[model samples]
Target: MSELNFIVTLFIAVLGPLLAIGYLKPILLVVLDSLCVEPLPGKIGAHFWVRSACVLAVAGALVLALSFGEFDGSLMQALRRALWLAAAGSFVSIAFITSRVWAPVQRRLNAQLNGGRG
Candidate 1:
């Protein structure tokens, strides 16, 4: 039971983000790309942070609820396991998104500072 829970938790942590990106990446990209103040996108970083946190929080709550119950072979158990996997995956996905969004900007900024065209 413990092993199952651990595996489910790990799966959730890993897979949730992958799915999130697969589904929500376009929106994320648009938000990130529209960050320039000249065009007035209205502060994407704050909006993105809030949206990500809300989604993560809801997914986390579902995972916690699913993973805390007694062991059983019922349908609820199966759903709970699935939710656990999703939660874990969601976290991983966000981490990936964060890095993806920040890495390029950081590199470009560094290049500009170094007198490069970026």
Candidate 2:
């Protein structure tokens, strides 16, 4: 393939899907809000972490699948790749969740120590 073709293909296959997946949650939330659905609660609530992890994992698999072009590869290989992607995505999600959970608590503690300063 020519250099230009390869670059375009790479961007479309990898970057496009990733960008779409990254925006999926926010987009859905906006749509739901537009429909007058009940406002969602904070992420610290029950099952929020698990749900986020699943979404991220599935998004990761889908994003990875966009670049899958080998017709002769074994099913096991594909499954392994998908599983790895899911695991990595879940880890990253958990890290974000942990920081999110900690940040508010840290801020509250700091405020108390600082004599109720905002």
Candidate 3:
């Protein structure tokens, strides 16, 4: 890739997953509250922040891995797979939270739409 293209790609790769995660964070909190789901141990405070940072770093590392092409040794290979693991966790968490959050609204809308039906 050209310099400009690589730069743009790197920026998007780093920002894209983060933007999605940031957008979902608040909604997840609300859903967790409404459902009264208990958070895991050590998931609050600094630990939570560290996990979020890991997600961002994994994304950036993945982008770097792909951009550079080819790796020598098992460590880079492991890091590349870690990117997939982190990305899966991030996106899957969002999906699960969104569904929980959406279910109530969908039920309400369906009730409203069918209100006049026999």
Candidate 4:
């Protein structure tokens, strides 16, 4: 592909997943809250926050390690890849958390909507 096309394609590829993941964050928060409730006792929110932080930290480290390569490309390419990795990590974690949070509610909603009268 042409350089401009490649850049646009990369941007879209990076952003699409990031946006999808971003949208899922609140759902994951709900899930984390629900799961960490009684089983987690008084520190539920803290626990979830810590877990998310840890995930981000790990992702950052991994991205840094993977991105360590030759200095051949333009600075823009490097910056784009860095941003993409950050977005990828954020979105993936959010999606994970939201999906977990959504599972129980999804089941209940499905049941109720299907005429369970719940």
Candidate 5:
């Protein structure tokens, strides 16, 4: 591949997943929320953690499964790459979920810490 093409491919490979995760996270949150029989009590509660864990597990499995078929490297190298991708995906997933779900709680805490300043 030409230099430009390689650069473009690299950019997409890195940013594409991040963008897709950001876009899909809200929908995932909605689906997970709908699975709950009763509305969760607080902004950050047990159900919130459960949903986050579920998302991480699903994302990790997907990363591993997808990476497994793509790598032509040795078994150890492939496993390492897959694990790294899973870790990155889990971090992104958690960051997305926390930023969305904990926004209210964070704002409240900030206001309290700032002595009710806006």
Candidate 6:
């Protein structure tokens, strides 16, 4: 691929999963909330794992679906690419969620440690 094409492809590969996760996360949270599923007390790990699984599943399925037609080359190669993209997307989504969840907590803890000056 030309440099321009490579850059565009890279951009789409990185952004696609983020956009998918961004759109799906709120919907998933709403559905879970409506089901009255409460987070385990003092247990963020379980929530993180569940969310990670969900992100992987959604990203994988989307990649699989789109790969058949959207990607070039042999089936196996396309599948390999799809899986890699899905994994990358899941990691990005998880990192984003982690930062969003922890940033405020970190700030609050800092404030407490510094005698409420933060």
Superposition TM-score, candidate 4 onto the true structure: 0.49
Report the number of the highest-TM-score candidate: 4
Q: Rate the local accuracy (lDDT) of all candidates.
A: 0.57, 0.47, 0.51, 0.53, 0.53, 0.53
For model 4, residues 30-80, the per-residue Cα lDDT tens digits are 655555556565357735664564455445434542554213466566556
User: Distance (Å) between predicted and true CA of 80, model 6?
Assistant: 1.5
Q: What are the TM-scores, per candidate, against the unseen true structure? A: 0.38, 0.43, 0.41, 0.49, 0.47, 0.42
Question: Regarding lDDT, does 4 or 6 come out ahead?
Answer: 4
lDDT of 3 by residue, 17-87 (tens): 66666665665555434443345433353345434544754455455545552334354444454455446
Model 3 spans > 4 angstroms off: 1-19, 25-75, 116-118
lDDT of 6 by residue, 1-118 (tens): 2344333344455455656666666654543333333554323544454466455645644554355323445545554565566566666656665565556567767878899654
Residue 64, model 4: Cα distance from true site in angstroms: 7.2
| Highest lDDT against the true fold, candidate | 1
Model 5 stretches astray by more than 4 angstroms: 1-38, 42-45, 60-70, 110-118
Per-residue lDDT tens digits for candidate 2, residues 1-118, read 2344333333334443344345544543443233332344443332344455446545554455445522245554544554455445545554664565567567667878898554
The clash tally of candidate 3 reads: 0
Candidates sorted on lDDT, descending: 1, 4, 6, 5, 3, 2
Cα misplacement distance, residue 117 of candidate 6 (Å): 9.2
Off by over 4 Å in 6: 1-72, 116-118
Clash list (residue pairs), candidate 4: 28-97, 28-98, 31-101
